[model samples]
Target: MTLALVTDDMTTGVLKTTDGERKSRTKLYWKRRREALSAVALERLADLGIEFPVVAGTMTIPEVCDYFSISRSTLTNIARQYYEELIEAGYMPGSVTQPTRYSELALAHVAMILRPSTSDQAMIIQKALGIYRAPRGAVKVHNQSGAHVKVCGRVLDEAYKLVSEIREDDPEEVWKALEKRNRHELQVLTVALAALVPNDRGGLRAWLAEIGLGIHSDAQNKAAVGLASLVPSRQQVSE
Candidate 1:
């Protein structure tokens, strides 16, 4: 009878593990997995000059996956398991009920758990988060030659008008919209402009100067003028 019972248990493939034991093992696995993924993701961010701790934007699930190059299922698992802690860290905490939203600081905390204090990457990111402050003056300096003029008056007003016509969206949104223009469109525009202008080299050079595309050197200007002579004028094409 005992032999028959052992065979039945073997056939059923049942193991004698308590719920607590299973929970503990699963929690341990999650911890190790989170640490490994965080190490890889943080390294990539560091290489890209982005420290996660100080990054300001909140990210949706898709954005996070794209930014970190992590699989959606893995992120779902991590976020689900740590939902409460994420909520404490300012995440909305409805991953199971609604879309999961994550902030940079929350992601930093996820890495901090079970991660060694001696990790240089982690230390650097944390240090920047803790002590870094925005500068009061200009963060970037541009080198200007004698030809460059500061934007003001009518020039500034025209620039503002141009920007509003291009995009009334936020700066990043405007950049994203501009990024949709491919190289082919630029080539087509260049060819069309070159064709429309009259075939006179001096006239082409003058037009180029007016449009702020004046060739820097006499040699380059000569080359541009020569190329213009080769392209048929709009009147020539009509004939």
Candidate 2:
């Protein structure tokens, strides 16, 4: 009696004899190659901070094969063996429905490892708080219209609250926020704010300078300076 094993290769399915004869040699060869590929993928996933079963959750068998340029059989075998280890180790959630959804814990771990530094955090806080102030005379114009613009009450309140809580508790949170800002916005804001406030500790002064400079220069250094000096200074007064 001949025993047959049925297998699929996505595009096609085939049957092979279980006995070590004829087509069995080719099947075994393919199997070995598949297993090697799976091992490579498993090692890469571990290095990338993907929690075992959870990382498996983030990709389908085919996706793993495609991402690592491996065969489906190897991917399936690796996932089946190590996925349980991942779950047992609490790297993956207890109940996972799909292979494409990793646990939040895994994502958090990756983010913590990838988070930025403190000075970057401070620059971000400064830029966010600094961009809401009014021009020296613009407030009078605004007051004439009965429109009182509250910088803290409006723009910076939420950001400030978040930053204060984080500065003492999780300094990394501050760096994350700063890293999210556009580089151009950050550079322009930094340069303009530096020129205006000169003193870094005062929030109100920093905000006003940032806004005044931002509007005058559209955060452009050349435009900011030109707009800043648009009004003739006392030094430029002629007798």
Question: Evaluated with TM-score, which candidate comes out highest?
Answer: 1
Kindly give the stretch of ten consecutive residues in candidate 1 with the minimal lDDT sum.
1-10
> Which residue pairs in candidate 2 have backbone atoms (N, alpha carbon, C) closer than 3 angstroms, thus clashing?
57-99, 57-100, 217-224
Could you tell me the lDDT of residue 60 within candidate 2? 46
Model 1 global lDDT (CA atoms, 0 to 1): 0.50
Write one digit per residue (lDDT tens) for candidate 1, span 1-239.
Answer: 01112235357744356666677886677555444544355555566586653334666777665645455764566677677766666565554667666776566654444122323344454443342223355323233444433422334444455446433445445445444767754444344445444443355455334323443445546646544433455676578
The candidate maximizing lDDT is: 1
**Candidate 2 ranges beyond 4 A from true positions:** 1-57, 88-239
Worst 10 residues of 2 by lDDT: 109-118
